[model samples]
Target: MDNNMLILSEGMHTSIQDLGRKGYRAFGVPISGAMDKYSAILANKLLNNDEKLPVMEMTLIGPKILFEDNSLIVLTGADMAPHINGEAIQMNFVYKVTTSDVLSFGNLKTGARTYLGVKGGFLTEEKLNSFSYYEGVTSKEKVQKGDRLKIASIEAGLNPSSSKIKVKSAHFKEKKLEVTKGPEFNRLTKKHRELLFSKEFKIDAHNNRMGYQLKNKFPPIKNGEIITSTTIPGTIQLTPSGKLIIMMRDCPTTGGYPRILQLTDIAINQLAQKKENDSFKFDLESSFDFLGRLVNRFKD
Candidate 1:
């Protein structure tokens, strides 16, 4: 396995990520991983790699790289116009890259992030048992132009093989995010609760891996102050100033704001791919339907 990729240019923010660090949140470690887990897993599935294998996660722009050795690769998530040696390549399809072949991207067609999965996952040092990158947690938080990613070495001659899988294009077009009542959902006034589900919320310009700030001001909950309790991705916090903050993959482990709503796993995945300025409505789901949504998310 002499496969390695030389980064000719780092696009926007490219990093190596797997599922995430699972057990370190008790120590205040954030679970940082691919923003679009569905697409990341799809890339791995096409390569026949482990579902949790680390892949290159890129936001908006993508990196320019030169393959040092022949290898199989797949791209998923956002339709970043990927090209090999100046030729355009399609998403969700496994392709073979010859030595010295350069990979680059053009305009982002849809979604916010993209995932690149190599046949053998990138060989990178891990922290807290996860390849997911986070500042202070990983030696290198983001991919750099001069970085050389270590990959599995391959023999000079091997039979070529690849696969293509189609996914519902509707997933990328969905604008309604289903959410369940949060711990503090009842603390809001009845009218405010009604407004929450009725009002349209646009993603603010401050959106990042940490979280998203909703453009609309949420009605503050009575006695909104609370001890910094355990928090996770999808926890919607309503601040005293009537602001809504939706936790994301790199969000802090705890928060003091009132958690007014909790996005279902499906909603989190959907919101993860959403970019700034994108608007969405919260579709409140019943408890019974929430469980069914959870089951359906994994089924896909």
Candidate 2:
């Protein structure tokens, strides 16, 4: 029998995602992948799969899946109260499931997304060198009920020891996101700059894969719009009406709003776990220090 999992219910929003496409942003393609990359990687690592292997990313809620063959799996990010065959399972721990075993989830304990990783990863369709599903870029934007997702077959005789690693819960609970000054950071008035750091901004309901709109507003910049500057995930823009928008995974390649600050990669991952109405403060870091840390990370 083929190794596949039948999706009985597509809970909220679920999609197959990897590390995301590379070098396609030049063609106006947005990098759409798992919102919580750190958690996704952890899920794959627990199963001894490639860090970039595609996994099931579940948002808010999770799906109900029925296994058709024996497989190894792990769940990470957000305690959605996962259960297999009516038995609750622990997050971040590897488990083996046989055919006919059912997997499901309950209420969200914390965080906004959950990642499920198979032993050899899900065999989803790939485009532009990624399994990430994006509208107009992939055949399917998200998984739906009655879908049969193909998975790599696992060896029946293989028996791997269970993982003992424990990820810190701080990533999901962190409220201060680290950021660096953007190109137009110097154009802001001293009062505006102070407000940016001091004020606790609430995430507006206009939050999604594209970007997040903050509820707090600042004084409109002298020149609100830029010359259609390049933008990537983590670019925070300020609009003419004092609106703040933080670009996310699926944001456009270029934007006209004034770029006020750029979030670090760590901050981007941290912010991904946040949901609507969540409040957070900015922890600005000097450009020189941020650069030094980046260099050290690469050197290590």
Report lDDT (CA) for all predictions.
0.88, 0.91
In the range 77-158, model 1's lDDT, one tens digit per residue, is 9999999999999998888888899999999998888999998788988888999999999988899999999987655665
What's the C-alpha lDDT at position 292 in model 2?
Answer: 93
Q: Residue 155 of candidate 1: its Cα lDDT?
A: 52
Candidate 2, 148-174: lDDT as tens digits: 999999886766566557777888889
Please report the candidate that would top lDDT against the real structure: 2
What TM-score would every model get versus the actual structure?
Answer: 0.95, 0.97
Which candidate's TM-score is highest?
A: 2
Q: Which residue pairs in candidate 2 have backbone atoms (N, alpha carbon, C) closer than 3 angstroms, thus clashing? A: none
Query: What are the runs in model 2 whose C-alpha is more than 4 Å off?
Result: none
All candidates: CA RMSD in angstroms?
2.0, 1.2
* Residue pairs with backbone atoms closer than 3 Å in model 1 (clashes): 1-152, 1-153, 1-154, 2-153
